[model samples]
Target: MASFHFELVSPEKMLFSGDVESVVVPGADGDFQVFAGHAPVMSTLHVGVLKIAGNTNAPQRVFVRGGFADVNDSGLTILAEQAVDLAEVKSDQLMQDIRDLEEDVADAKTDAERARAQAKLEGLKALQLAVAH
Candidate 1:
């Protein structure tokens, strides 16, 4: 199968950089997949798991807090706020983090702030569910 270069980076470090057969990204609007010769695009990502398929040990699933995805002449690049490999994400720790986010939702001062916090909480909930499988 043909492949394309894919890179996933967070503030701390680059989590992945290699050729991939395909990549499923959680776009702000919805989930989308990219393949070789895909049209160039810039998309804002939502909190969700990024699925990478290729010559990997197993299908890679990485949790991304939120980020931007860019596909250009070079390849696909993900600039994530925070990212963790599903295999490395501890369920207990994730639940506790969600609890903290729930508090933020409750403590939100403005309607907009509350909405934002709620969205983030929802994303985390979705991530937790994905990691379960």
Candidate 2:
């Protein structure tokens, strides 16, 4: 299979930089795959797991909160708002965060706040499901 350079970076640091066979991104509109010679495009990513293939070891799954994916002549570059490798994630902590978010949603004073909290809670739940499998 053909490979292409891929980079995943966050505000804190660079998460990944290497060649990959494919990458499944969590685009705001929907999920999309990038290959070695994919068409040039830019997309806003939502909260979801990024599936990466063609690495040295097993396929990787990384949780990304939000970001932008830019695909050009060089390769694919993702500037994530936040990202964490699933392998390094602590289930206990994730559960705690979900619990806290639930409370925030219930205690929200405004509709906008409630909606934001609810959306985040849903995103965390989705991440939890992905981590379980």
Candidate 3:
């Protein structure tokens, strides 16, 4: 696969900055991938996983709350609202996050709100399952 400079930034710090072969992001509409020479685009990300594969290390999976991804002529940059390495997340913490999301689903007032919350819950569950094994 071809490579391109990629950066994943959060409020706290710059999580990853280097060349990567592929990046799969959880876009608000759906999952999409970026590679070298990809067309320029700006996208809003949803709560889900970002998979990074490259030459620097083994593939890494990151959980991002919400964010934006920008692909330009130079490279791809992801400005995440909140991001964490799935490997470092404790089971208990993940469970708490799930509980919170569940509450959001339960507290939703309208059908649209409930659907959004449910989508978030499902994404979290999928991430949890991926982390478990």
Candidate 4:
């Protein structure tokens, strides 16, 4: 099977780096898939799950806060502000975070602030779905 080098990196550390058959990323516009020999491109990413199909038996999942994906002849590079492996994510913590965001949204004084909180809540819901499976 054909594969491409996929690297997920954050400012604090390198999360995952390996060769994968394909990757599904949450592009700013929507979701997009990348395969081996994919055309070179760059895009802004949203807060959502990134799924990578490696050579192993199971696929890997990572939740990214926000970032940019740079795909080139070399490979795919994800520069994320925050990224967490789904396997390592704690459900309790995530639930707590969701609750906090909900409260913030309720108390939000301005439309912009409410929108931001809503976005955060939506991201957390996506993360929950990713972690569930």
Candidate 5:
């Protein structure tokens, strides 16, 4: 089977770097899949689960808040604002975080503030779902 190099990186450090048969990303428009020799493209990513397949050791699942994906003949690179592996995620803590963000959203007085809070809430929701799956 064909495989491609995949790298997930955040400002802090590189999260995952390995070979995978395929990967599905939560693009801004919708979900999209990448495979070996996929056409070169770039996209803005959304907050959701990044599913990677064909790792003999284990399947990889990652939660990303938002990012940009750069794909080419060689591989795929993700530059994310925040990213976390499923195994390291804490569901209960994420729930608490969501609750806190909800409170902030409720208290937001300005439209801009509310929109910011709403975006955070959505990201938290995505994280919860990612962890669950």
Candidate 6:
């Protein structure tokens, strides 16, 4: 399979930089895959897992919380707001966060607060499902 240079960066640091066969991005509109020689494009990413198939290492999955993906002649670059290696995520911690957010949702005093809590709860659930898979 053909490979292209791919980079995943966040405010804290560059998480990934390598040649990859393909990448599955969690675009805001929907999921999309990019390969070498893919059409040039830009997309906003949602809170989801980004999958990378690389040349040497085992396939990797990283969780990204909002970002932008830019594909051009050089390769694909993802400027993520936050990135965390799926393997490094502690399930217990995630579960605790979900439980806390659930309580926040239930205890919210205003409509805006409830909405914010609900959205966070949904994102956390999605992350939990991703970890399960």
Q: What is the C-alpha lDDT of each candidate?
A: 0.87, 0.91, 0.87, 0.87, 0.88, 0.90
Worst 10 residues of 5 by lDDT: 56-65
**Per-residue accuracy of model 6 over 1-133 as CA lDDT, tens digit each:** 8999999999998888889999999999999999999999999998889988865563399888888999999999999987888888899999999999999999999999999999889878877888898
Clashing pairs in 4: none
Off by over 4 Å in 4: 57-59, 97-126, 129-133
lDDT tens readout by residue for model 4, 1-133: 6988988899999877788899899889998999999999899998788888865633377888889999999889999977888878888999999999999999999999999999879878878877876
* Candidate 6 RMSD to the real structure: 2.5
Error of 5 at 3 (Å): 1.4
Q: Flag the better candidate by TM-score, 1 or 4.
A: 1
* lDDT for position 57 in model 4: 38
Single out the weakest 10-residue window by summed lDDT for candidate 3. Answer: 50-59
Tell how far residue 74 is off in model 6, in angstroms.
Answer: 1.6
Runs with alpha carbons beyond 4 Å of true place in candidate 3: 96-133
Tens-digit lDDT string for candidate 1 (70-125): 99877799999878889887889889989999999999999999999998888778
**Winner of 2 and 5 under TM-score:** 5
TM-scores, all candidates, are 0.76, 0.78, 0.72, 0.74, 0.79, 0.79
Model 1 backbone overlap count? 0
Off by over 4 Å in 2: 57-59, 101-123
Model 4 worst lDDT window (10 residues) = 54-63
Q: Would you give me the overall lDDT of model 2? A: 0.91
Steric overlap count per candidate? 0, 0, 0, 0, 0, 0
Pick the winner on TM-score between candidates 2 and 6: 6
- How well does candidate 5 score on lDDT at residue 42? 96
Candidate 1 regions with alpha-carbon error over 4 angstroms: 57-59, 96-126
Question: Regarding TM-score, does 4 or 5 come out ahead?
Answer: 5
Candidate 5, 54-122: lDDT as tens digits: 986533888888889989977999999988888777778888999999999999999999999998898
Worst 10 residues of 1 by lDDT: 55-64
